[model samples]
Target: MSDEEKRVLLNNAWCRDADASFAFGYALRADKFGIVIEGKCAKCGCAIVRCSY
Candidate 1:
């Protein structure tokens, strides 16, 4: 995904390190309904997923 889209997802995801950015683990997955982004919080190292339609 583009940097802008990644930024939006990372900003909106519910993560412990709210002030930090995220490091994407894989490419985005899209289904008929929406998109799924899987990654980890840069600061806390916790797994996170952001889904968007």
Candidate 2:
């Protein structure tokens, strides 16, 4: 996929809620590898987890 497509996919990735207090964001790359996430929990103050595909 092109860089633009990859960027679009990354911007619309899904984030799982396992043990997080805040909603995390994800970004998918064109390599079809894994997803990257950012942000921390507001209540637990723990690092947000990202479930990659």
Candidate 3:
């Protein structure tokens, strides 16, 4: 993904266990509703998926 898009996605990211990490890149994929960005949390390492329309 583009740097700007990555920045925007991470800006709105959240994790159930803790604050999400600012990683290098996310696993991007397509979904029925929108684009899905997957990553891990900084504190707890839980899976985090953010969907962008």
Candidate 4:
């Protein structure tokens, strides 16, 4: 990994895709009562997949 990547990792700012992070979507809650998204790729949807060897 590069020094910049290392710095970001150390700071817990690492993300898989910067563009995808901006991609927003909405879905009904389990109770189907109301919306839950705050207009960002976060909450229970924001995820970062990493592989370790």
| Candidate that would win on lDDT | 3
TM-score of each: 0.60, 0.33, 0.69, 0.23
Going through the candidates in order, what is the number of backbone clashes in each? 0, 1, 0, 0
For model 3, what is the error of residue 51's alpha carbon versus the real structure, in angstroms, after optimal superposition?
Answer: 0.5
lDDT (C-alpha) at residue 44 in model 3 = 75
Candidate 2 regions with alpha-carbon error over 4 angstroms: 1-19, 23-32
Candidate 3's C-alpha runs over 4 A off are 22-25
Worst 10 residues of 2 by lDDT: 22-31
- Tens-place lDDT digits, model 3, residues 1-53: 68898778777888766765645456878789888888777667778788899
| Model 4 misplacement above 4 A | 13-53
Question: Per-residue lDDT tens digits of candidate 2, residues 1-53?
Answer: 47785455444433343443443343323335565444555445555544345
Q: Using TM-score as the measure, which candidate wins?
A: 3
Write down the TM-score for model 1. Answer: 0.60
Clashes of 4: 0
